[model samples]
Target: MFFRFLFAVPVIALFCLPASAGQYDAQFRQFLKSDVAPAARQAGVSQATLDRELKGLTPDTSLPGLVGPGGKGKPPKINFQAEFKSPARYFRDSQFNALVPRGRSLMKQHASALSRIEAKYGVPRRIILAIWARESGYGSAKIPYDAIRVLATQAFMGQRPEFFKGELIAGLKILQNGDVSRTGMKSSWGGAMGQPQFLPSSFLKYAVDFDGDGKRNIWSSDVDTMASIAHYLSAHGWVKGRDWGYEVFLPENVSCTREGPDNRQAISAFVREGVRRVSGKPFPANEVNQPGNILLPAGRYGPAFIATENFYVIKDYNESDAYALFVGHLADRYGSNKGFAGKWKPMKETTRGAVRNLQQRLEGLGHDVGGADGLIGFKTRRSIGRDQEKNGFFATCWVG
Candidate 1:
């Protein structure tokens, strides 16, 4: 179910196989009493809360990405031979077509609440709506797991147990605070709880009660859900008036290898280099002096952009350039509903293993492939473009 949540973003964990409960039930319960209980106590969770929440709890081995009871090994890899994708396919027009109309209607229905959120957080209504639309289909997507159960199981055996341990404690604290009932505190398998899909830690830090019902019911209240999303983005530094990014035409002489956040310069610097908005409009005067970077997700093979810090702010929500782009572009669609002006030229679909191999090879050649993690991040794409330029081939800045 958590894997299903990423349909609108990076598919981070691809564990499709159901987990089966093994022989560790007794030891897992021991772990909760000795390891988790003290932490929850220190975090101000009551004994009653712990007694009620942990009773009858057993490890849900059917959940994906868990290790053995000792939690010493890496979680098993997603079964290999699953299809890998090109970044181009991530921007399919059909995905946008299905979502835009639904999002527009939600905007009108939640218009008043959205206005208050923007005024409070300085994040615009459309951006907030886009995040809500993506996270849980404007609160319609069914979240299928109990948050405490999911967090406890992951803390017991899932990958990154220490991180989940902290989140597990936070979930206990959420229960102690009376925000939601045991049944209502639902989550995706990864423990991103409720409509905004916040991890328990995030829920504790940023989830807000906008409707003033004396409880923050992000699970069913549209107002709380919208406010929470805006709060997360604003806390991560969403710029008030700036758009996330703009599609632009990068002139031939301007190097594609300049694409990344580390290489940011004033937008005017790009204008001087002949990068123009595809709309032929001048760069906004306020934007010209601010920092931006060249963004070519599929290199020269697809749309180009001059992305602002706000774009990176979206990435803070989920650390993928593609994820942020989907949110930003989808937000734009609720207004005029147009697709990218640049086309995604067809390319071979390659696996993460292949991409990691290419990254390793690039590293051997004295290039920074951004640690060879098997994702074609901006660094990897630019490194590929640099290599292509050295070979006297036109740099597509992509895996051709």
Candidate 2:
């Protein structure tokens, strides 16, 4: 009876374990076979490749923001009470200071290759270096997940599985392309692959074999990575011999409400309106008659700029005004190493819920709050400036 009790205890413990832990394993395999295989095969993936890669594949439930099968598992609401930082926090000097030396070193190290890429692609070596530093910390950032697994899991259960489904097929095609082995194709949890962090589709379209190797290996080749980034920017219309934009002193007479890509005026026109480069130099002679739009990122409360069309091209790399500015500013610092001339005014920390409430109020008043997504975009900033102007007050265009 003592021996029987011991065996029974072990059996009971085994039965008590959570079934949900590997609950999706069978379902995930079936999904790969039934759902993914047809599309991947149609995209020229072979039977052996599918059978090899899909074997024992299981969804990684631990990945953040997953929704379950058929939407039965409701996604958790975003924690709106989380602290929302001012845009100024993103431009901290310490961040730029740390990146400068490393970028300049890479510029010298890869000078020959970067020179070639620039002659071919028309993107500056510094801009390429800044993007490289920002994206992967010059390839030091740990990208630890398997690209195949990440694409597979996200396709199965992540918030945008349909979009990931397409990327998953693209990823398999990349595998079929023989550029990198499955083991070597490391990625972020979101499946942005390799040092330049090209999505699998971007890899197919823009990745280049700069080293003259048969394969476009962005994973371990500095030449391929740098060239690939240049190619992407160039394809997206990076104009040669142009800086992204210039920081400027916006006089009080120039209304902050005039901020946006749509409100463009010639550099000469801006100079006529009393906008001066923060550097106190004249706007570049070549750009004087060229169009520029006012970019008041923190509204009138922060440093302002007259951004050129090249600034929007950088925005194509990452769709945020702050992101483009960081890349461009960092690129400039490699030459001069100076921080922004204007100050980011001190502001109290507020919750995203509070910001969302403000956006909702703006929306109710028929202002475009850029979808009330709790994050402030240019639309929200301009609407605030317009409202402030309508109320017969100086328009700060930023949150109080």
Candidate 3:
């Protein structure tokens, strides 16, 4: 299971309107009236609702897209030295530290809401708070694009129409409910909205008015936002009191692999396969019996983690291993652990191109590293590390 912060267009670009603003706005308005309205009507949205939501809306041409002017070129191929050496590659310690106080404050402020959610849903308040802090910086950050325009653009662009179309309808429903003004319904370019950064469909399904003011106002309502996050996690199988899994030390000569949940042997089977507990802290036998899959996100240079059901539950919020690890680690920190026992090996900067090359090279050698997408995800990183060990390149197999 992958988990990480939901992807966002860089916050800096959020306010930068596109150069073709007028033309795109005109085109978008026409598209909405001609296409989106019809689609919404077909989806059971009332004409009155559609009229209120779609009228006066304009396209945000500033949103990032593949091959667009603002799009960066594909990231460089993986090279162990460059990624580690680059100052920008790793998470900034200072930034993370700064976020802690704010995170703690929000945790306290929303303590009651969190406690109530935990009692109802069986997910920890700290974990929910961690997600809240990470997603929108405790509700201070603004989502800069109009939800409808972004969804319409993504749907019309045809990359993920089936998914975005559903999101669009849900967004219209949000507007129809009068919970937010159409003008105030700004969202991430990918269509995630408000503090918990939910896509419209997710908001519709999980958002709640915890304060009971009769609106699920995720944008400005702290109670509603935090509760919505808890609800989402609960719906996704978050088990209260169960650790999301711990860091482990691999024994020598172990056949360590990053397998997906479906392909993984039972936790008992893997325990018998010689996986050993590395945390030094003892766990209950039942907890050990819970199935997990290993993930080496930053190749072998970074720490490895065994993801549990709760990890996948976090992934239901976002689908990146880096993201899941961050949330899990943050949760661990907020709950009282500093970090993993093993230290990440130092390496150079890893560019998108290098990551793609690493995947291509690994796949060519008969290891399925998923596609040669520039993202150096767990599968690709693990395959590379294993291959590196086999080839005597380096046991750590740090990537750049």
Candidate 4:
């Protein structure tokens, strides 16, 4: 549900509808009067608020990934020809280096408040800081769009119109509550509001008034922003006193096919099977008996990790392995600025269509690659490895 606003790696070039030129203004008003106002009223928004806010509102056709009035055109295309970078480039040391110092400074600056947040929420401050940096560059990124306008536009014209319609209603409710003025409620073009990049529904559920300002002002309050992120993670099952994951050395005999959260075993089981921390240290005593699963983000081409359940909790914030790994690794870097122990080998450039083709082949042979979404999630990675094993080759868990 969370979409990273400022720190996304552009894998697909999005297409926007041409500028509205007021072409859909009449339809948009009809939609508000007929479809939205009733729902907003059900959700406790007043008729006066609707009249004052939505009057003369035109759909913002210039937002990215638009697909006409009802997703009528071919849904936005994945730029199948876009460049695909290897994990080495994606997790370059320089990227972390650029973010670490500021993160460290912020960590110290907010030490007392962070201690209280951890005490109350059981999420580490570093994790909250890392997510903050990733979501909006620790509140440095500009969020310029009006949240209601963006949500209303998406509900009227963008892909997943019904979903955005719900968010639009939530945005109106936020306004009706007077949490923020409509003019001050800024958001990304995608309608992820404020520094933590929460959607309107998420803001309603998780935003808090941490600075005692009597309003959950995520737009300008760092305390509110950090606390809100911690609250979201905690609500999604952030395990107390546990870390996300650790980089590890996987022996050659350890098949990469043994990947994914579904294949979880005790951390000690992986250790007994010859996994070792890349730091040459033992797993924490508390963690040794806890469940973890192998995470091979780049199969055998990049770093290996034994990810704790807490790792998946981070994934709930953004459902991407790379995004979770980036947050986890950056959180770790707030204290120790080390890079990965296992190097990411260079990969041949491939496209989403190529990956989809490979997934289809694996699926035909009775492997589930998580719906052939053209992304190399754990299911796809392990499916590749399993196919290699079936062909009597070493399973690198990577695309050949």
Candidate 5:
């Protein structure tokens, strides 16, 4: 599910005139008429729908990450001055403990429907529940914004206005289809709507009405929401009978630089090289012959994993490795209610700027740190490891 914090362009700045708060209403209305209406109309939305939905609509300038009227403000920074937390904090056992009981209960409550959903979609119920808890606290999280207003506001003044422009049109199309009322179509400030937190585009493509209620009502229907999330994962190529990953013990002799999807090999190969499940159980027979890759989210300073192709499939839901790992770990806790056996070792606190400097240094030596983005992605982590090996030190694959 994409978080749609939407944004806008410059020549159109002339329409803003004085660009004051009061005038923003006038400007937004103009934008709807001039920019949005035609695109929405071309996409089969009626003139009546346009006039009715857009009448008196105004921009929400208070939304975070806006870049001013014409997307002219500097992009938001990563708060480089703040200390980056370790995985121990991110993957707090109390946090998972609190979530697991509810997840287990929901699993039983929805067991029948979930079974059918799993049968149809080939996605496990546990994974679906984990994603549900993560996305919107299993529909308990409030999603209170008018989706049209949020999308329209984003299209008018937020960053990535063109992207939001498309989303705004899609939002209008959702309204025109009568799948949801304009008033009932609540979204986050960023425009990810309903329980599954689907963007309008995602709703159109993947949402399913499993409850037979004639609406893919992610807002209030637990069954529909669960099925919709399952449908999303299935569509994204979630492999049946495969686990996302396994917590593992990586031998000290193995380099952490071997992390990432591109470095995948048979799980059997990893076991042959001395990787073993922290549980001491063998890799599942179904998984042993299939491909897997090293995954050290905090490099070697945290728990080690041998992630499957299914792990990357989960990542397709949300790009962050931490997010995918969290979902996988949470799903596991449904059965065992245990945390990772391997510990997340402590490291010195460092700023994003400091990390970026390290990344830049690695890039200077012709290593690809994935554009020196300051965030330590797999490329950065592995680059650090490779650099360490080059300098005759043990490769930790992390920012020291």
Candidate 6:
């Protein structure tokens, strides 16, 4: 039986701290005792569990914004052009293709266990394999940080406290259940653990024991790991037969601003606006009724995708649109297509600090570039391009 809980906290009274340098080990301990301990107790976590998992565990001050002295002076900037243009850097087609045979072999290795899981739950095998390959490189990758320390840091010092606080408690429960040792509860910076990179809260809800060991162990057990991934997607409304989405050609006159998910005009509406599917194929009956949004991931230069409801489902797993595109494209590479056909434009690769400085400078000049968030989303890029045009820079009107 899978136990799922959705603990939604309103985004009110949450304090945002600037990235500061200092060791908060004492403060962190105080936070655990005063704030986290009571909350964990209310959520039914035993005192024994808290001591076993969190006692003597120091906070990881090396997290993104919490780096100590001798580290780089400013937060790292995102180099958009370099990231996108060099396929080897980010999108390695050949290396990704090589994983297909390995993925198939692993799928076959766990076939019996996966078969039992599929019988009980209607989730498909390929989708499970796709998620497995995309996250942690089919279980070959190692999760790097201590889960509790990472969660606590994010909760106390990082941006989203309420969300991370719930996850922090969920992680303690995983330790209490004896599924993982406190020492072995390693995970990503954001506290996503094990083979499928599940956030601790997500693991408690969606993890399953396919090996029948009476414990849902996702760290080392392939059977349990893959089944847990399958269960997660199935719970989150994954339709088996439908493609995640498709690469399509928009008409020359179709405004690129209408491409974001927010402006998801109905397919029929887009069709009326001279937008045609790139494949020259008729829309599937179920999909035509479903609204599709345009995504210009790299502004006007790169490939455009008409994302379906499933795309949002993928985003639920990882919020970044670029990450979703990478996963979807990686899956496509393994299954069918070689690569996207769109021509990419070159843009300056600015570091996170540089982008923030640029945004501040542009805003000072009344360009209305969104707040100095390091992420170079479409709005930021457009604002940058407009400023560049005014400043007499070689304006291709692209944002990095």
For model 1, residues 5-109, the per-residue Cα lDDT tens digits are: 222132445553354455678888899999999988988889999999999898887777677655676656643243344555667788888889888887888
> Per-residue lDDT for 332-369 in model 4, tens only?
99888999888888876787778889999889999989
Which candidate number would show the highest lDDT if scored against the true structure? 4
Top candidate when judged by TM-score against the true structure:
4
Clashing residue pairs in candidate 1 (N, C-alpha, C atoms within 3 angstroms)? 19-61, 19-62
Q: What is the TM-score (0 to 1) of candidate 4?
A: 0.96
How well is each residue in 102-189 modelled by candidate 3, as lDDT tens digits?
7777778777777888898888877887788778888788688878878776654434655666788888888878778877777877
Rank candidates by lDDT, best first.
4, 5, 1, 2, 6, 3
TM-score of each: 0.94, 0.92, 0.81, 0.96, 0.94, 0.73
Better of 1 and 3 by TM-score: 1
What's model 5's lDDT at 165?
88
Residue 34 error, candidate 2, Å: 0.9
- Candidate 3 — worst ten consecutive residues by lDDT sum? 1-10
Clashing pairs in 6: 76-352, 77-351, 77-352, 259-294
Can you write out model 6's per-residue Cα lDDT over 88-154, one digit (the tens) per residue?
2344567567767777777678788878877766665666677787787888887878888888877
lDDT of 6 at 50: 86
The Cα RMSD of model 2 versus the native structure comes to: 9.6
lDDT of 1 at 166: 94
TM-score, structure 3 vs. true = 0.81
- Cα lDDT tens digits for candidate 2, 341-382: 999876555656677899999999999877876666788888
When summed lDDT is taken over every stretch of 10 residues in candidate 1, the lowest stretch is 1-10
